[model samples]
Target: MPKMKTKSSAKKRFKITATGKIKAAAAGKRHGMIKRSNKFLRDARGTMVLSEPDAKIVKKFLPNGL
Candidate 1:
């Protein structure tokens, strides 16, 4: 049988932590930032760990890691 391939888009968007948790950037900061509040921009600076259920889905796409 052939080896399973990872999802390319998911590979770019999700990251695997040292402990195997999925980390992702918060959404809603791509455009229209001029109208957004300072607090919202400040709060979205770092990556966030996905929940267990969501992480399971993402793990399937990152077979080899980033």
Candidate 2:
């Protein structure tokens, strides 16, 4: 059978962790930082693991481990 093609967008935006969870950049940090609170900025500093339900959907896009 032919190899399945992984979603290009997904590969760029999401990463599979060593334990198999999806890691993605935190949202809401693109602009308007002035209106955002210090806590929000601090919490959004790094990438976060996708929830179980969300991870399940992302898994389909990454059929082959990246």
Candidate 3:
């Protein structure tokens, strides 16, 4: 059988942790920071683990966890 190819976009955006959970940058931090609250910005400073359902979807795009 041929090897499955990982999605290019997924490879760049998501990472599989040692425990297999998907880690990704928090959303809503890209722009319009003036309107966002300080607490929101502080909380979204680092990567976060994707929820179970969302992780499952991303897993398909990454056949080999990265």
Candidate 4:
């Protein structure tokens, strides 16, 4: 059988933590930050865990991760 490949896009955008949770960067902070409020910008500056349903799908792409 052929080796299963990891999704490169997923690998770049998400990370599996030591506890098996999908960690990802919050959106809306990539560009045009000058128009957003300080609070909004600050809020989008960290990682967020994927929701259960979403996590299930993410897990498929990152089988060895979580």
Task: Choose the strongest candidate by TM-score.
Answer: 3
Ten contiguous residues minimizing lDDT sum, candidate 1: 57-66
Per-residue lDDT of 1-66 in model 2, one digit per residue for the tens? 988899999999999998999999999999999999999999999899999999999999997653
Alpha-carbon deviation at 38 in model 1, angstroms: 0.7
In model 3, the runs with Cα more than 4 Å from the true position are: none
Best model per lDDT: 3
Per-candidate TM-score against the hidden true structure: 0.83, 0.91, 0.94, 0.81
lDDT of 1 by residue, 47-66 (tens): 99999998887787787642
What TM-score does candidate 3 reach? 0.94
lDDT of 3 at 65: 62
Model 3, residue pairs in steric clash = none
lDDT of each: 0.87, 0.92, 0.93, 0.84
Clashes found in each candidate (C-alpha, N, C closer than 3 A)? 0, 0, 0, 0
List where candidate 2 sits over 4 angstroms from the true fold. none
For model 3, how big is the CA root-mean-square deviation?
A: 1.5
Per-residue CA lDDT of model 3 for 1-66, tens digit only, reads 998998999999999998999999999988899999999999999999999999999999998763
Candidate 1 to truth, TM: 0.83
How close to the true structure is residue 3 of candidate 2, measured as C-alpha lDDT?
Answer: 84
